[model samples]
Target: MTRSPATPLPPPKARRRLRESAALTQPQLATRVGVTPATVRAWESGRTTPRGRKREAYAKLLKTLAEEEAARLAKQEQEREREREQEALPEPKPEPKSKSEPVALTPAQAFDALYAFSAPALVRQTFLLTGRREQARESVERAFQTAWERWPEVARDRDPVGWVRATAYEYALSPWQRFRPRHRHPEPPPADPGDRTLLNTLLRLPPRHRRTLVLYDGVGLDLPETAAETEASTPATANRLLHAREAVAGRLPALADPRVLHRRLAELASNERLRAAEPPAVRGGGERRARFRTRAAIAFTVALVGTTALTARTAPTHYEPPVSPGQAVRGVPHKVAPGSLSDEELELRQKLRDQMQDGPERLSPRLE
Candidate 1:
C-alpha cells in the first residue's frame, strides 16, 4: 500500500493556510505574488511548489504574517488588561491645576520633534544621500531603533532629533566607506564639463567646509548652530564659511555680476540636493555614538594599513638615475648601445658569452 501517493505532500502546509486565510480573490493573491491564479491553486492543492528559496520565502511570509497578527492581538490584550486594572482602582482627588495654556515650542523644540514626524525634507535627504529608499529608510529606522532603545538618555539630550539626523547621515555614508572598491572608478556623470568640474571641486573641499556651507546656507542653519554642530570655534567657523563662499564665488563666471552670481551659485548648491535638504533628527544616543566610534576606528585602521602597504611596496623599487637608455639593471649598469661599450666591458661580455655557449668544455683554468 503506497498510501495514495502520500497525498501529494499536502500543498506545502503554509501555502494552503495562507491562501484560505488571505480572503483574497484567487487572482488578487496571484497578482500579489506575481504568479497566475492557477499556479497558486496548484500550490494550494499540493500539485506543485514555487521551488527552493521561493518556496521557503513563501512559507516564511505566511509564518511572519501569522506572528505579526499574534503580536498585535497580544498588544491589544495587554492594553485591555491595563484598562481593566485602571477601572478596578479607586479614583484619586483632583488637585486644582494651573489655568495657563501650554507654552508654544520654539524652533529648537520643533526641530527635535521633527525626528518623530516624517518630513519631505527628511525623506528627500535620505534618498539623495543613500540613493535607495529602502536603504534610506533603514538608516532612519536604525536611528529610530536606537532612539527607542535609549529613549531615556535621548530625551535628556539637548537636541535628540538632530542626534537622529546626524546618525542617519553617518549610516548613509557607512556602506560607501565599507565597500570601497580599489581600482574601480565611479562612472562619470553625463553633464557639462564645467558643471562636473565645479561638482568635483566641491567634493574636494574639506568635510568641515562642506558641512558648514551645506548646513548654514544650503539647509538653512545659522552660522552659530552650524559651528556648534561642526565643533569649530565661532571665528574659525566664520573664516571657513567665508572661504567656502569665496571659493565658489571665484569659480563662477558670473561672479562679476552680483545678482547673476548669487543665482548661479544657488543653482550650483541646489544640484547637490541631498546636502541642501533637511534631515530627520537622530534617535539613538548611546548606541549610535558607539557605532560611530567603532566605524571611525575601522576607517582609521584601514587608512593606516593602506598607506603603510603602499609606501612599503613602492619603496624598494625606487628608480635611480639612468646611466644609459635601457641599460639599467637590478643592481648593476651596462651600456645601452654597442658603441658605448668600453674595451673592458666588451672583453667581459665576450668571456660571459663563451662561458654560456662553450659550457666549460675547454679547460682554460686561471690560477687565483
Candidate 2:
C-alpha cells in the first residue's frame, strides 16, 4: 500500500522563531507590523492569523527564518556526526624511543666538550676584536685555562661560552699588552683585501659598539644574553647594536647582513685547527698565590698594628705642654742667652779640645 506524504508544520510556530531570529521582542515585532503586541502574541500562539498584507509579510519572514534555522541545525548535526566518527576510530600509537640516549658528562668531560666546541669560534671572535692572531690565541687560551681551573663553577654556569667570551674579550682589550715588546710588532696585513677592509672597519668602531655587535650578531646571542655579556641594559644594548649596524652598513654594505657576517666569520674560522690544540693546563698556583698573599697581608697588618701599639706604649714620652689653664697661660718660648750654642756645637767643641790635648799622638797620617 502507498504511504501518505507528511503534512508541513504550520507557520504560527515559525512566526515566534522568525521574531526571535530577527532579535525583535513581541512589542518590537508589533511596532514593525503596525499591530498591538497582544495581537502578535496571539498570531504566534496560532490563536489568530494575520490577514492581507500582514499575512503576506509574516509568511515571508517565517519562511526565511525557518530555512536559516534548518541550515544551522544541519551544520551542527554534521559536526557532531563527524566528531562521533573520529571517536570510533583507534588512536595513533606513540612514537618509539630512540635507541641511543644522550650520556651525562662529568665536570672534566663537560669542560673538554666545551673546549673542543668553542675554542675555534672564540679564537676567531677574539681575532676579530683585537686584529692580532697571537693576541687572540693567547686570550682564548688564557680564558680556557681559567675555565679549566674553575671547571666546576664554569660547568654550573647558565652559559659557559658567554662567560668565556666575556673573559676573552676583556683579555683581548688588556692595556698592559700595549707595553709588551711582542705585542708592539705591527701585524702583517690580512691576505684578503675584503677581510682587511672588514677588520679595519670593525676596529674603527668604539669598543663598546664593536663588542655589542660581535656578541649579538657574531656570537649569535639573544638581546638579553648579549646585554648580559656586554654588561649593559637591554635598551642600551639594542641602541648600541643599531648604531653598530649603521656604522658597518656605511662602510661595507654587503657585510652588514647578519647572515653574511656569520658566514664570513665562519670562513675565517674554518682553516684554524682547534681540535689539535691541547686543553689549557689548569694552574692552581694563581689561586694559591692569591690566598697566600691575602694571609700574608693579614699577618703583616696585624704585626704592624701590634708593633705600633707596643712602640706607642713602651717608647719614651716627649715633653708635652700641660692642659691646665694656668700652664696654658704660662706656656711660652723662653729667652736664650746671646752666647748660647746648640748641643751639637758644644759637643763638637769638647771633641776638638780633647783632640788638641792629645796633640801629635792622636793625629793619624793620611795616605797620599
Candidate 3:
C-alpha cells in the first residue's frame, strides 16, 4: 500500500543565518526579537517557520542592511537637490537705493556677524588639520575675526570660505618661518615614536606641505578640489603632499609602520596636555573667502611653467650669428653670399628675402 504524503519542512537554515548576521546569541536574539528559544531552534533546524514578531524582526534586519547600501545613492540625490534649489533661488538684489548712497554696515556689527558665522567651520578645519583640539579652536576663531574686518572685498566673491581657509592655513604655516635661525631643534634621527610621536612629526612639517597633505589625505579631496584649495594641480599637489609625508617619514622609523601612524594619531587625541598646551594661531574672525583665488593663481603659475617647458621642446631655435664689420652684404651673411658663396647660396638668400618681404603681417592683430 502507498504511504501518506510527508509534510514540507520549515527553513532552519534561514533562521540560523539571521542569528549569525545579527551577531547575537540564540537566546539573546530570541529575547530581543520576541521569539522563544525552542522556536528559534526549530526555525534554524528547518523544522518550522517563525510567525509574527520573529519574522518581522528578520525582515527588519535585512531592510537595515539594504538601507546601508543605499546610503551613498541617497546622499548623491540630496546633493543634487541642494544644487537645484540653489540654481532656482533668485539672486538677492542690493537694497533698492540710490547709487549715490553708500550701503553702510558698522564695523562692529560686521565683525561680530562674520566671527559668529565662520568660527565653527574654522575651528573644525584647524582641529582636523593640526589635531590640536583646545588651542586650534581659539586660533581659528581669532584668525577669522581678524580677517573679517576686510570682508567687503571678500563678500564680492562667490566663495568666501575658501579664501578664509587659505588665509588661516598660511597663518598656521607662519610659525615654521619664525623658527630661530641660530638655535634649531635637533632632528630626532630614525625609528618612529608612538602615536604622540607621529602627531608631533606631522606638526613639525612646514605649513604648505602640511596643509597639502591634510587636504588630500585627511580631507579626502581629489586633485581638483585640492588644487582649488592649495592652488596647485593634481600632479603638483600630489607631489607636494607626498613629499611632505616623506619628509615626516624620514625623521622617524614609524613612517614605515602603518600601525604606528594610526597609534600615534590615537595617542595625540588622548593626550589632553599636548592638545591644551599648544598656543593659538589666530585671535577671532575667520579667513576671508578670496583666499581660494590665491590658491588658483598658484596653480595657474605652475600650469604656465609646464606650458613653457612644452613650448621649448617643439619650438625652432634659430640662433642669429652676430654681424662682423666686413661680413654683411644686403643683410645676408658673406659666407652664404655670392663671389665667395656658390650660385645655390645666392638663390637660397634671394628666396629667403622674397619670403620675408611677401609674408603676411607677422605681428598682426589676429595673431595678438
Candidate 4:
C-alpha cells in the first residue's frame, strides 16, 4: 500500500493533558524532544506547530502518553467491574456440619433487653418522685407495661428511654396517686437523720420543681433536656430547679453545691433499695389489663344499646290521666236521735197497733 499521511497533533488542551499525564514539565519534555521549553509552551498554547525531526519525536512521545492513559483508565474500569461482580455474587449456603451461627434478636428479645437496661434506673428515679419504693416499682412496671402495649410507637421513638422515663415520671407524680391510701403512707425514712431530712425536703417541693430538680440535678440532664422532658420552658425549668435547690439547701447547708446535691440525690435514691418487676411479667400484666378494660367497655356499650332499645320499645306513646284521688260513699245511713223518739212516729205506732187487729182467714177469729 502507498504511505498514508501521519495523524495531526492533538489540540492545545489535549497536548497539555498528554504532557501532564507523563508527569513531565515543559522544560523536561522539551529536553527529551530536542526542543526549547519556549517551543513546547508555544505548541501547548496552540501558538505554533512543530515540524521535521522535532515534530516526529513530539508526536511519538504524545502517542506513548496517550497509550499509558488509556491503559490506566482500562485498569481502573476493570477493577470497578470486578468489584461489582463480587457484590452481585450470592452468599454461600451454610454447610450442615458447620457450627450453628448466632441468631439476631426478635422484637420481644430486644424489648426485654431494653427493659432490663432501663427499668432499674427508672424505678429509682420514680422512688424519688413518690418517696415510696412500692410506688416506684409499680410506676416503673406500669410504664414498661404501657411501653409494651404501645411498643410499635415506642420502638420507633427517637428516644425510647426518654419515652419510658416520662411515662414512669408521669405515673409516679400523678396527683390522684397521692390520694390512694396504699401510696399515701410511704415507707420509712432514711436511717441517717440528715438524709431523712434531705429526702423530706425533696418530697415537700412542688411536683414540677421536684421533677425538674431530679431530672437536672439527680439524673444529670442538662437544663434544655430537663425542660423538654418536663414539658416546660427552659426558664421555667431553671426557676424550678433553683427553687428546689434552695429548699434542699435550706434544710441541709452542706448540699448547697449542685455537684454535692447531685451526689446526695443519687445516694438518697440508691439507699431506697428499689427493685423493678420482670419484663415478661409487666408485659403480661399490660396485656391482661388491656383485655379487661376492653371487655368492660364492650359490655358497657352493649348494655347501653340494649337498654336504649328496650326503653324505646316499651315506652307509652300517649298521655295517661291519673285516677281520681277521692273516693265516694256507696250509701247513707238513716239519722237516729241519741236519746229522744219523735211524737209523730209514736202516734203512727199507736194508730198501727189499733188498726192491726186483722187476722188471716185460716187462723183468725174475725174475717172479711
Candidate 5:
C-alpha cells in the first residue's frame, strides 16, 4: 500500500509558538509525534524537514494548537471589549509640567540606582552557581564593584544587567574558587531534600554546562543571547543546554519542563538568604580599589621615568681612547756610584782632565 501524502505545516517559528501556546514542551511533543526531542528541535530550527507519518502527526498537532490559540485570543479580545464598555471611564488629564527641568542623575547616583535594583536578585542567581551563601553575596558585590570601576564601559553597554550577570557568574564558577580558603569544604545543603538533590545535580555538571543551563533555563535568556553570553556558538550552546537538561531531568524528572525548571531554579536560589552588600559599600570599595591601582601605576611610571633620566645623565657623551700598558727599555746602561766606578770610566775621566788646556784636543774631544 502506498503512504498518504505528507501534510503541509506552518513555518518553524509558528510551529514553535503553537507548541508553546499549547503548553507542550519539545520533549512532550516529540513523544507524542514519535520522534526524539533533538529531532523536534531540528525541525523547529529549520535544519531538517520531517517526512511521511511523523510529518503528518506533527502538522496535525500544530494545526489543533494554532486553532485553539486563535480562539483563545478572540475570547480574550471579546472579554476586554466587554470590560471596556462596562467601565467607560474617561482617560485622566495629563499632569502639568513644572517650569524647572528635571535633574539628571550623576554617574555615581546612576550606578547606585542600578545596583539597588539588580543586586539582590543577582546575589540569588549567583547562589545557584556557587551554592555558598557568602560566596554568592560576595560574587554579586565584586561584579558591581567591577561595574563601578568600569562604569563608563558598563553604562555604554546595551544590556548592563547582562554585563553584571556574566561577571558575577564568571566569578562564582571560577575554578580557582576551589582552592580558596573558604572553599576547602562544600557549603551546607538545603533543608529540603528535593532542593538538596537539585543543587547536587546542578553542581555535578561541568562548569560550562551548569552556566549554560542557568543562563537559558534559570535566567530565561533566549538561545542566541545565551550562546553569546557564554561565548559559544548557537549550535554548541544548544548542545550544552540539551545535555544539561538531560542531566537535570535524569536526577529530578519533575524539572523536565523548562518552565517548571525556571520556577524551581528561582525557588532553589531563594531558599538561601543570599543578601548582597549595600550599594554605598560597593561603591566605596570600588572607588578605593580604583584609587589604589591608579596610585600604584603612577608610582611605577614615575620610578621608571626617574631611572631612565638618571641613566641618561651618567652615561658618556663622547668616545675616549683607552690607555696602553707599559713595557721595559731593551738597551739602557746600569748606574754606578763614584767610589765603585769601572776602570774604563776612570781612564776616560783622567784623559778628559789632562786634555782640558790644549785647544785642538778640547775642540776634538767628542768621543776620545
Candidate 6:
C-alpha cells in the first residue's frame, strides 16, 4: 500500500514553531492574540487547541507570522550574500602605523567607550530607582557627563559602573525635581500589568528598601556591592532585601518567588534599555570642578567649626597667679611686712642676736 501524503504538523507543533520563528514569548503571543498566557501554553503543549472561529483565527495568525518570518530570513540571507561578495573583493592596503599613535587608550577614549557600553543599563537601573523614565534618562546623562569630566578618577575606580549607578541614583532621588511640573500624560504602560503593579508597589516602599531592592534585584549586583552602593552594612542590606521582597509579595503574590522576581526585574531592565535615549555630550568640566571645590570648602569650614566648638566645650581650664618666681617663693606675708614687729618676730630677732654673739667673727664685718 502506498503511504498517504505526509499530513500537516499538529496544532501544538505548528503553534510552537510559529511562535519561535516570530521571536515572541508565550505571554507576548498571548497578548497579541487576546488570550491568557496559560491558554497559549496549553495550545503549544498539545493539551488543547482552539475551536471553531478561534481555531481559524489562530491558524491565519500563524500563517501570517510564518510568512513574515520567511521574508525576514530571505532579507537576512541577501544581506549575508552581499557581505560575502564584499569580502571577495581585494582589500585595500592598510596604512603604516604612525609614531604618534598612542600605545594605550587615553582617559577620554576610555570614558567614551565606558559611557557607550554602560549608559543604557545605568539608565535602566536609574529608572527602576526613580520610577520615571525622563528622570532616569537625565540622571544617567548627568552621571556619565560627570564621569567624562572626571575621567581620570572614574577610569581608576574599581567599579566604574557602580560609580555611575550611584551618581544616577543620587540624581534621581533629588527632592528639587518634585516641585517641577510633570508631564500631563505619561508614556504607555508596560505590557505586563504585574510588572506595572510591582513597580508601583516598589515605589511605595521606603527609600532604603527601594534602593536595596533595585541594586540587588534590578541591577543584578551582589550583596556586598549592593550594600556598598546603598551605604548599608551587608546584614542590613540583606534584611532590607528580605523586607522589600515581602512587601512586594504582599502586593503582587507572584513576585514572592525569587525566580519570578529576578525574571521580572530582568524584563523591566531590558525594556527600559530599549526605551532609553542616547546620553548627552559631556559638559563643562571646569564648572563641575568649581562646584566640587565650593562644596569641599563649605564642608571643610563646617568640620573645622564643629571641631573647634567641641574642643572648647571639653577642654580643662585652670588659673594661676601672675606673680614673679621670687615673689611667689617669698610668700605673700613677706611682701606685706607690718611696720611693727609681732611677738614672734621679736623672739626670732633675739634668737638671731644670740647666735651672732656666739659667732662674733661672723658678725665683725657688720659691727665694724
- Candidate 1 wrongly placed segments (more than 4 Å): 1-145, 156-158, 168-179, 182-198, 253-368
Give TM-scores for every candidate, taking all chains together and pairing residue i with residue i: 0.36, 0.51, 0.34, 0.60, 0.58, 0.48
Inter-residue clash pairs, candidate 1: 11-46, 147-283, 161-281, 161-282, 163-282, 164-281, 164-282, 164-283, 165-281, 165-282
Candidate 5, 1-368: lDDT as tens digits: 99666789999877877887888988899999999777787787676788988888888888889889999999999999988897768777989888796778999899988998989889888888777889988888889999988899899765799999999999898888888899787677999998999999998999999999998888888886787688766789999999999999998999999999999999998887677778899999888989999999999999999999999999999999999875656896556555877999999989888875655533555675
* Residue pairs whose backbone atoms clash in candidate 4: none
Ranking by TM-score: 4, 5, 2, 6, 1, 3
lDDT of 2 by residue, 1-368 (tens): 99554333356755666667656787887776677776676676665567777766666656676788788889999999998999878989978768697777876677777878888778888877888778888888778777776777777654699888889899888778889898758888577788778788888988899888888777787786676567666678899999988888898898778888777766654544433255534234334555788999999999999999999999878877878654333677666577988999999989888775646665678999
Query: What global local distance difference test value does model 5 have?
Result: 0.87
Measured with C-alpha atoms, the lDDT of residue 233 in candidate 4 is: 61
As for candidate 5, its clashing pairs are none
Q: How close is candidate 6 to the true structure, as a TM-score?
A: 0.48
Candidate 6 lDDT trough over 10 residues, lowest sum: 273-282
- The lDDT, on a scale of 0 to 1, for candidate 1 is 0.59
In model 3, the runs with Cα more than 4 Å from the true position are 1-142, 175-193, 204-206, 245-368
Q: In candidate 1, what are the lDDT values of residues 1-368, reduced to their tens digit?
A: 66332112233555555555555555777776667665565565454557654555555656665676678779999999998989878989888767785777754465456654644355444543433445556676666556655666666554676676667666755646446453154544425665465555555666567556656655566665666566565578889977776776677544444355445435553454332222333433445776888999999999999999999987867678868655456877655564588999989989898776747566687999
Better model by lDDT, 3 or 4? 4
On residues 1-368, what C-alpha lDDT tens digit does candidate 6 reach at each position? 99554324356767787787787887898777778676676677665557665566677778789889889999999999998989978989999999998788866667667878888777777777777787788888778777776767778665798888888888788877777777454656667786687678878998889889887777677786676567666678899999999999998887898888888987876765344444334445434665898999999999999999999998878776788666354454555655998999999999898785656553444554
TM-score of the candidate numbered 4?
A: 0.60
Model 4 spans > 4 angstroms off: 1-104, 183-186, 318-368
